[model samples]
Target: MGVLLDSFGPALWLVLSPTNLVIMVLGIIAGTILGALPGFGAAQALALMFPFTFGMTPEAGVLFFIAIYAAAEYGGSIPAILIRTPGTSAAAITVLDGYPMARAGKASRALKISLYTGVVGSIASSFIFLFAASGLAWIGLQFGPSEMFAVGIFGLSVIGSFFGDSPVKGFVATGIGLFLAMIGSSGFSGLRFTFGQASLLDGMPLIVVIIGFLAMPEVFRLMAARRGDDPEVASLGGENREANHVGLKVMRKLVPTMVRSTLIGTAVGAIPGPGATVSSLLAYSEEKRFSKHPEKFGTGIDEGVAAPETANNAVVAGSLIPSLALGVPGSGAIAILLGLLISKGIVPGPLLFQQNGPLVMAVFAGLIVSAVLMLVVGIAGVRVFALVARVPRYMLAPFVLMLLVIGTYAYHNYAAHIVIAILIGAFAYWLETIRVPVIPIVLAFVMAPIIEANLNRAMVIHGGDLSFALTRPITLIILGLAVLSIVLGFFRARRARHESAAAKENLGETP
Candidate 1:
């Protein structure tokens, strides 16, 4: 206890420094702006900023990125509510009801609810981080290659469960992502895929692929669908002011949703790959299931805003578990962070905790501070940001596309990457039109390599006995859970279909 307290004290002091606080504020502001803009995402922001961190200490750089990540999640709600355009993929769930509320002139109220719920959820999840991180670290240290592979499989399965209404589409996205991930050189034999191009030798850059799939295509879509009209922002004056004012009563009402979503977010975040989008969607669905008036969900209820906002923010803390402990990135942002850590000579594995205990503790402290800072910044700037929603898509779209191009090229000074980003963006937009969820693809891209590497290692060690994956008790338990998740999802889908059929039957009878 004494040693732990001593370690924590210095970490708290490091983050409490005025310089660090200022950086946190700047990161949150910058991230919020990027998140509010269309075609910009947290991953791109991190990739762009990653080079700048080369000069800073690992602790400071990591903290800066965490600040951006946390703020971006909250910032996404701005565009989601105001324009029906999600600033981040995770914010897509917010648009289901948030845009409706905004159209009804309750944009201010929706923004306030999102801000408050995000803060509460972040704080709640940080506590989970504080308590669970060390234990998870200890457990992760014992995982063999086979166990890790199983964990990766479990993560991929979770993605299938969390994506859109069609499980087949989710699996298809995952398969494509995994196939794309295999494009680079094979880790074992040094053989290359789609051989012949020098650029293909190093395999596709994760940044390039992510940017292509997520950012570039959105730019073209925005341009093609360009509308001159601006969205209306709810003013803070008169009745809107009264409605927007967040009070104790509102907080109390939202508390249940916040708590539930936070729990769901933490659990999903703790998983290996699905990250915030899955967590937010799961939380949103759960909220709908539990709501007294489920019909109001997509009509812009505060509960709708609160549930997803809270879950997304909570995911920030949860993602850190695997990254900090086992060197596995829980999400895209964490993957970037892992790369940054590697560049800084900080290898993140079990040894990380032993060698960099103080630094690890410092990061944990910084995460807590970032959460608090998000709340402060979010509340103070809510009105101004809400108004940013009124910016015309015509103007915003071009600026976002330019930023995407610049950020992509700036990463490796490669113009090819910019082209790649454009191609990916165009493809992603088409995929969206076809109702394919991007989350599974993104997650599969992130996890497939890890899974392949670990599985190959495990097989070599066990003389090709694949059963080693289940030989370990913990791995078996995880696999069990994965199977259970599939079963549950199947039943849930069936129940939803039955409910829809019954509703139609009742309507027919009434007519």
Candidate 2:
């Protein structure tokens, strides 16, 4: 309590400062614009902001990035509600009902509800971070290399959810990603998959590959399919003005749903894995299950938009709990933020609050301010951003390509990196045709290094004894869970196959 009181003044003063306030609003504006654009994400938006923040004070830079992170998460729902296309994976669940509402000529109402819920969730989650982060930091310090390895495995276990339809394809995609991660040289200075290319020494540029995998395929698909007509864009201008505003009565009814989804989002985010994508989906599912009229869920319902939008946007603050309290990141965007903090010499752990108390408080203050800014900016800009839906594929495509090119170059400034992005983008585009989404691959690529490095260290610590690595209590528990999950997943798959075959046989006999 004393520490909190001491930090309050510094936090408030920094937040209200002329420079930080201006930068925070600017970051929110950039975040909303980026989030409104399909295929753009918080990590990419932060990457774009990186070069600019490089010269600022640590407080200023961190504040700018935090605003962007919070706002972008909220921003993703804008496109999702206005059109079927979700701007980020975090907003994917919103499309189920948001687009439906838009189709029903209530795009403005959907956007307003989304903004309202986003701010509410953001505030709720921030309170959790404020009060809980310190306590969580203790658990974070207990992690060793072995424990981290186990955590990575647990993260990988989410492959079942990623490939809920076909475990084989999911594993295949994961294998591809792991193989890609192994491309660079060993710590002992031996090359693995370089194939004699000098640029391969660094393995692959993650930013370039990510941009390529996400952007190129979509671009190629758009060009080849010539998505000449987007009815949502044309229809936005014709939405009913009277139905555009969400009524006070309607807002009152969604209060419970908002609270429930915020709690779910905060819980999901506090854990090591199961990011915003899962949070929003779980919230949406729970909302539907508990609704008096479940049948009305997918048919332009306000609760549908509210639940997912609230949950996902809440993930921004919820995710920060782990990132600030522990070195472990909550999501890919947070992973990037982790790297940024390390580069700037701001180590995150139990000691972070003790050592950098004011900075931490400033971040908390920034998050609250940003949430308010996101709501205000979103309300004012909804009509303007709705204009994005009307953008022709021909115009949007070239502009996105240009941004991708620039983003890819911004990483290490290597020309060869740009070429690799081109090749990977082209490959990912073809991969999509086979119903193989690149998400599993991307997720695996992100974790492969963490798993490999940690596992190696754990073995080395125990003199190369595999059993010795498994002896620690935390490692043992996590690895046990990972093994149990894998076994369960396998059994479930077998059972599903058997049931499917029996159903097929029965259908054949019935005919």
Candidate 3:
């Protein structure tokens, strides 16, 4: 404890400095503005902001990015409450009750509940990041090649568990991602998959692929649809201040729901692929089960707003755990953030602690500071954000396309990347039509090369004996766990079907 305390002392001091504080404020405001805009989110913001971090030290770069991460999550709930449109995909569940509250003349009240829960969840997740990081990194060091490969497979299994009755399509998407990972020159072999195109030698630039996936799909959707009128800043039927105030009595009632949602969000975030969308939905479902008035969940209830808002924001910190401690990104945006860490000469995982101990603590301090900034900055600018959230998709889509083109081309100063990003964007947009799980595809692509390199190295060491790879104690443990996880998932899926059928039968009997 003394050693930990001494190490954290310098990092704490860094967070208190004026420069870092100023950057935190800037990130919060920028993230709120960008995130509150329809069809713009963390991925687009991170990609667009990636160039700005090129010259900073790794510690400061990470601090700035995390502030964007924490604040953007809270910002998403703004449009979700007032306009029946989710600013981010994870906020989709918030629209269920949030819009209803607005229509019923309590939009401001719903916004306050969302803001308060988001902060509480972020604070809780930051504490978890601070205390749990070292232990998680230590455990990550225990993984051998086989163990890591098993871990990747476990992450992929989320595709089946989450796709809601369709595992085949998810696996198909995973296969494509693996194929993308196999592009470029084969590492120790003199062969390449570039098809004689010179620009393909480097595989796809990470930024290009990210832009294609995030920016392109959003733009296409906006272009094809008729743009709706943006909502009014005053979300209520009338500007009644009394109905929009969340007093102590209501806050006291919401405390238990927020606590439960925080725990759920942190757990889901630590896992690699399920992300905030799943966490919010799961928390919403569980909150209903735990509620005294379960039927009121989608009926403009404050608890409904609080449950999902807290879980999704908590996921911001939760998703960082695997990326920082295990060197495996928890989501696509974090994968992009991981690329930034590598570019800055800071490799994540166990070695990170040994090589850059102070930087690790600085990261923790940054998260704590971001949580404080979110509370102050979010409330102060709520009105401005509400106004900005009304920006039309038609005007915004063209601006996003410009960002995608410039960000891709400037990253490597290659026009080829711009073309590649557009092509991939078109492909990714098509994948959305089929309900493919794109994030898992990107994650598998990133992990495939790592898994391949390690597996081959292990095989050569064991004289071409594949069975010897399974003999490592850590590898065996992860394999066992993987099997157990699949079994549990199968049963859980079956139970859900049974419950759904039983509900239908009960309804029939009542009629």
Candidate 4:
């Protein structure tokens, strides 16, 4: 306890410094702008800012990134509510109810609810991070390669369930992502895949691939949909509508939903894969199930806004559990953070905690401060962010595309990477039209190499005996869970179809 307290003191002091405080504030503000803008996301924002952080101390650099992450999760909801366009993929669930509320002239109320829920959820999860992270690290230390591979498989399977209506499409996307991951030089053989071009010798850069597949495509899609008409701006009410109107009563009413979503978010975050999108979707569904009047959910109720907002924001801290403890990132933003950590000569496994305990504690402390900063900035600037809804899509699209191009090129200073990004963007656009979920593809790309390499290593160590996978208790348990998840997903889909049919019959009879 004494050692822990001693370690925490430096972190606490570091976060309290005026310079670090300014960084946090600026990061949050920048993240909010990026998140509120169409075609910009946390991953892109972080990737764009990576070069700028190269000169800072590792502690300050990481804190800056965390601030952006925490703020962006909340900031995405602004556009989600005001424009029916999710600024980040995690905000997709928010649009279900948030946009509806805005159309009903309750945009300010909905935004306030989301901001408050985010602040509370973040604070709650920070406690989880402080207390539970060490225990999770202990458990992670016990995991062998077989168990790790199984965990990766479980993550890919969960992605299938989380994506849209078609599990087949999701799986296909996952398979493609895995195949893309195989393009790189193999660790064991040092051989490249399908490489005729010399430029492919180094394989695709993860940052480049992510930026191309996720960010650039969205930019193109937005540009394609550009129009000349000015967007209608929603006004935050005048003097009577003081920001403080988001009071204790509202917090009291939202407490149950907030707590439930936070728990769900934390649990999902602790999982090896699947990130904020899954957490938000699950929380939204659970809220719908427990609501007294389910019909009011999508029509724009406070509960609807609270559920997804709280859940997604909570994911900011939750994702770090796997990344910090296990050397695995559960989301794209964390994946970028993992790269940044690597660049800073910090390995993410157990050694990270051992070698840089104070830095880790400082990161946790920064997260807490960032969350508080998000609330302060969000409340004070709700009206300003709402104004972003009025930006012309034409102007925004070009600037976003330009950033994507520059960021991708700067990652390696290779014109080939820029061309690859454009090509991937076109391919992604085509894939989207076919109703494939890009999330599984991204997860598959991230996890495939990890799974394959670990599986091979485990096999080699076990004298090539396949039974080694089941011989390990952790691996066996994870396999069982994966099987159970598939079974449950099948039943859920069937039940949903039955309910749909029954609702149709009832409507026909009543008419």
Cα lDDT of candidate 4 equals: 0.76
Q: Is candidate 1 or candidate 4 better by lDDT?
A: 4
Give per-residue lDDT, candidate 3, residue 158.
Answer: 49
lDDT, candidate 4, 240-320, per-residue tens? 354325688888988999999998888777765557876886788678768787547667788989998999888888888
Candidates in descending TM-score order: 1, 2, 4, 3
- Report the lDDT tens digits of candidate 3 across residue range 347-408: 98857766676777777677778988888987776565444334455665676567557656
Which of 1 and 4 is ahead in TM-score? 1
* Candidate 1 steric clashes: 5
Models ranked on lDDT: 4, 2, 1, 3
Give candidate 1's error at residue 362 in angstroms.
4.9
TM-score of each: 0.74, 0.73, 0.63, 0.71
Pairs that clash in candidate 2:
none
Per-candidate Cα lDDT values, in order, are 0.75, 0.75, 0.71, 0.76
Tens-place lDDT per residue, model 1, 223-245, is 66546443332231224567667
Cα shift from native, residue 358, model 2 (Å): 5.0
